[model samples]
Target: MNECTYKNYDELPLMLNVVQVAAVLGISRAGAYELVHSEDFPTLKIGSRIVVPKDKLREWIDANTAQK
Candidate 1:
């Protein structure tokens, strides 16, 4: 997966694929797949295609971000 050029949430697409998710999270494609499969991860399945909503992804990050 190539590095994501997105510097902020505004740069992200409304829906993101596995590769985009990997880049956003700075993780490997395999890792992103694992996360997408996790029960808590936000995802939408449409006839065998899996995608994440950018808004939901941001919410997930906010919810899971560690407090200083």
Candidate 2:
């Protein structure tokens, strides 16, 4: 992945695929998949594709960070 091509999560499209989520979270692709599979992870399934909504992703981050 090109570091130059990375976008801030806030600047990403409204919906993000797993790879983009991984990039923003700085996690491995497999870790991103695992996160999306969690019951509490914010995700939407369209047919066979799983995507994370940008707003929900931010909400999830906020919620998690607030607990620390």
Candidate 1 wrongly placed segments (more than 4 Å): none
Q: Write the per-residue lDDT of candidate 1 for residues 1-68, one digit (tens) a residue.
A: 66888999899999999999999999999999999999999999988989999999999999999999
Best by TM-score: 1
For candidate 1, the 10 contiguous residues with the lowest summed lDDT are: 1-10
Pairs that collide in candidate 1 are none
- Give a tens-digit lDDT track for model 2, residues 1-68: 31324555557889989998888887888899999999899999999999999999999998888553
TM-score of each: 0.92, 0.84
**Over 4 Å off in model 2, which ranges?**
1-10, 66-68
Q: What CA RMSD would you report for each candidate?
A: 1.1, 2.3
lDDT of each: 0.94, 0.86
Clashing residue pairs found in predicted model 2: none
